[model samples]
Target: MPIKTPSELFIHDLSDTYSAEKQMTRSLPRLARAATDPQLAQAFEDHLEETRAQVERIEEIAEALGLKLKRIKCEGMAGLVEETLSMVDQVQEGPVLDAALIGSAQKAEHYEIASYTSLILMAMKLGYAPAVPLLQATLAEEQATDKRLGAMAEASAIEQAEATS
Candidate 1:
């Protein structure tokens, strides 16, 4: 296999995120539908919108840096989403399922948070200041979405579980 340079790695990171977000736009609606809880559903919907905007920002940043956006086929995201879907599939309508679903969703968000953080640092190191804010914007949205998922998990997961029991 060919080794990637540090700069190549940085661009690959951006490409990976772009691929993940593009795939996620398709996945979010399925997640929302799988979620039995209204709050969980709404969270997915909101993040869908946010994710689209994030993709746009990343594209803008790529353009400013004279780089074309590409896909590295983010296998991590694909696996995570696939696992979440399988987990949710077995969940019966109740709080436990809602809680489990929320947990899965949050796990996914945390992955995105880590990916974006590293990408932002790389962009800055590569002298892409304009890319910084765009990265920051996506980072903030990912964080916000993660936080929202956490809140939903706290409020609904256990309570729903108890009620179902």
Candidate 2:
């Protein structure tokens, strides 16, 4: 174990988050393809585009701070992704697939919201407001996606489930 300063901890978290976002860029495509709903697929595509901009923002924060971030494994996200992939295998047809996908994707987005919110607060307290906004920007996107997913789930998913039953 290494004794880490607050700055080091901040940097470590940033690196982990960076890797998580990068991982999503790849994962989102598969999710898009697996989606039974065209809307759901398009949502993933839009998110992937937003995610790329987020990566740039994070990198900008790293450069401004004179810190180099090394990609760290985010097991939580990896597990979430694996679960989603597994769900795809299990739910291959019908509206249930889209419902489940919205559920799984929202779970992932919630995790991201928590992570970025925490990171922003830490950056602010660490006297790094410039980085704070960068984290907040991502946080906002995650929240928006969550809201959008919730709407989709309510409008289409639940109705579909009821119809099938």
Candidate 3:
């Protein structure tokens, strides 16, 4: 995993993102169940589906490249998910929990956004023509998910959590 070229970097990033998305697919259900807000729960559920599709898209990229998709353990995502899980167990289940969920989920999205942005640049630099669009599509979804979470936090989750406290 010596990053000597842009292509090498791109593949490394692809593996990292693949691992992160896989982890999200598994962890999102817990987030959905912990959410007090029905809309928030639904959002997590919907994102779980989206994460699965993202995984497929990454697999397709690997297939096209004639490379086996190898997953590098994404320690960053693991830490974020672990913190969120801890919050779920320690916090009271209510709007506060919902707000914390949104915060944690947003952190995840931001990590994804940064990761994909770098990957897209590396792909383009390496003349990875097919991967550019696939990575872009995932990046756009991550950005949209972040925006949705922000809207939920602004419109309800945060305010409700504050009111409860």
Candidate 2: the clashing residue pairs are none
Show the colliding residue pairs in model 3.
Answer: none
Residues 1-165, candidate 3, lDDT per residue (tens digit)?
477866676777789889999999989999999999999999999999999999999999888876666658999999999999999999999999999999999999999999999988887887778888999999999999999999999999888999999
Candidate 1 overall Cα lDDT vs. reference? 0.84
lDDT by candidate, in order shown: 0.84, 0.88, 0.92
Comparison by lDDT, 1 against 2, better one: 2
lDDT computed for candidate 3: 0.92
Q: Which ten residues in a row have the lowest lDDT in candidate 2?
A: 1-10
lDDT of 1 by residue, 46-92 (tens): 99999899888878878888886554799999998898888878878
lDDT tens string, model 2, 1-165?
A: 463798888888888888889889989999899887799899999999999998899999999988899757888889999999899899856688889889999999998888898898889889997898778878999999999999999888878966876
Q: Could you tell me the TM-score of candidate 2?
A: 0.95
TM-score of each: 0.93, 0.95, 0.96
In angstroms, how far off is 101's CA in candidate 1?
1.5
User: What root-mean-square deviation over C-alphas does model 2 reach?
Assistant: 1.2
- Please list the Cα RMSD from the true structure of every candidate, rounded to 1 decimal place: 1.4, 1.2, 1.0
